[model samples]
Target: MIPPVSAPDFLVKAGWPGAAIVPLAGDASFRRYFRVLDGGRRAVLMDAPPPHEDPRPFIAIAEHLVADGFAAPRILARDLDEGLVLIEDFGDDRLKEHVDAQPDNEMTVYSRAIDLLVDLHKLPAADLPPYDRAVYRREVGLVTEWYCPAIGLAVDEDAYNCAWDSVLPIVEQSASPIVTVLRDYHAENIMLIDQPEAYGLGLLDFQDALAGHPAYDLVSLLQDARRDVPPEIEAAMLARYKALASPPADFDAAYAVLGAQRNAKIIGIFTRLWKRDGKPRYLAYLPRMWGLLERDLAHPALAPVAEWFATNIPADKRHQALQEFALA
Candidate 1:
């Protein structure tokens, strides 16, 4: 991947002259990150090139998180016109790898993450766009818009949306307080940093933060699209959050609704990444996503959505169908 042409000058202006820029990572977006090494000091340079992306949201959210005593990366410098920003590096100890290596510490680490969310929800949400029903419908529509067509299944789009319409209101009308929902709060996006202020967790990829139901981020964490959070751990963590937050009695239902919604969105997105963007690596996660979606669909709150899946994308047409397509 090519680094931004203006990155060098931006870094130099930000006081990191002649820093060695090393490729770090890229997500499912138009952004790329690099580690800028200047002698003994190191920082991350975000290259969110213009027209397609704007780094303002990330900068604003990062500043908000830091100001609220959270462990989001500190913004060292920025050039909004070029869509480049120099921010603090939280190191490479991502929660996903950390847990994968030491399975025994999973509960302890996840418990801390849940506690962080509980604390974060207590604070007033940042000025951000609401994760309203329109957003939900647009996101969930990705499955039908991308996945179904990719697999050559002409689904009944009307019925599919009808199912979602029946349940979207439940989450939107949740009794729990609306809070800043870090749209991608999974293990991969979290760094196991040494900062106590963030309860040893360094947040990342929160540029798409939104004011939504408290359960959305929790669902994102427990029902991770990229990793398997053990069933027991998932249950325990859900219980732990309930005990700490004392959310509404229907919180479990809200969790299930959001979980199903997010999983469906990921399925469509991963497919689009493969078909439209020519990035097929994301296809490998289809089975895991389907598994999580099935679990969420089993919840009584998702009756309509579950029925839609059963009738339209039946058992054989789910992940198995996608696997066959991949092999073909």
Candidate 2:
């Protein structure tokens, strides 16, 4: 996902007087980035599409995290009206890429990262918006409207309705106390700052942060989109998170329901990405997500959900639909 040299070129040619520039890689999003190497100095350039990708919220969140003790990339300069941002270069060591490539050092790496999430959840989020039933329904309903229609399936109207009906209440009731929820607290969004004193992770892509269930991030991390996290590793992480986080009342039940709801919404979204955006790589993550979906459904609290999925989403149909989307 490395962008072309255009951005770096623009910065070097038109940026600060006598500044140097170098293009760096970017991830899959509406955003693009470049490295600014200005006469032995360094900075990163962010190119968000003007009128489409706003940078104000990103600016706000990045500053907030920095003030809150997280090593987010520091903003050097900005042009909100033009949608450009110059930030400190945090290097190319993405947390997901680093851990996946170094299997032997995986646990040590994730343990450290998990601790960061624990701290984030412990912080109060009284001001954040609620991730209520409406939000859950909207996310899941996207499947019925966007994904199902794109795939040419009639979107088993009855099934889509019943599926969410059976699942949302379970998710809502078991929801844990709210916290500063970084919506995409998954691996890809975290950059491992390869430094000495601040070996802590650098948070990125957090403009979507809100206040909601704490376990949501843990699931997002363990059930990552780009890699296969081993069951043993996932178990180890879950146990560690539970031990560190003393959940209120019936935490176990709430966590399970949340996981199921999360996985289901993810599956639909991945499918939608394939059909709607023509991004087929997302389909590869489906097989893994489906298995996780089944496991989460195994929780006794989600029995009705399991039954609904079993009756409505046939094994052959799900498999065939996924393949069609991938091919499409």
Winning model by TM-score: 1
For each candidate, the alpha-carbon lDDT, in order, equals 0.92, 0.72
The residue ranges of model 1 lying beyond 4 angstroms of the native Cα positions read none
TM-score of each: 0.98, 0.86
Best by lDDT: 1
Clashes of 2: 1
For candidate 2, give the lDDT of residue 300: 86
**Superposed model 2: Cα runs more than 4 Å off:** 1-15, 18-23, 26-28, 156-166, 169-175, 194-199
- Tens-place lDDT per residue, model 2, 232-299, is 88888878887887766666666677777777787778777766666777777777777777788898
Model 2 lDDT-worst window of ten: 1-10
lDDT at 48, model 2: 81
lDDT of 1 at 264: 97
Tens digit of per-residue lDDT, candidate 1, span 1-328: 6688898989889999999999999989989999999888999999998898999999999999999999999999999999999999999999999999999999999999999999999999999999998999999999999988878889999999899999988888778898999999999999998888689999999999999999999989999989999999999999999999999988989999999999999999999998888788898899999999999999999999999999888777777667679779
TM-score of candidate 1 relative to the true fold: 0.98
- Candidate 2 residue-wise lDDT at 326: 53
Give the clash count for model 1: 0
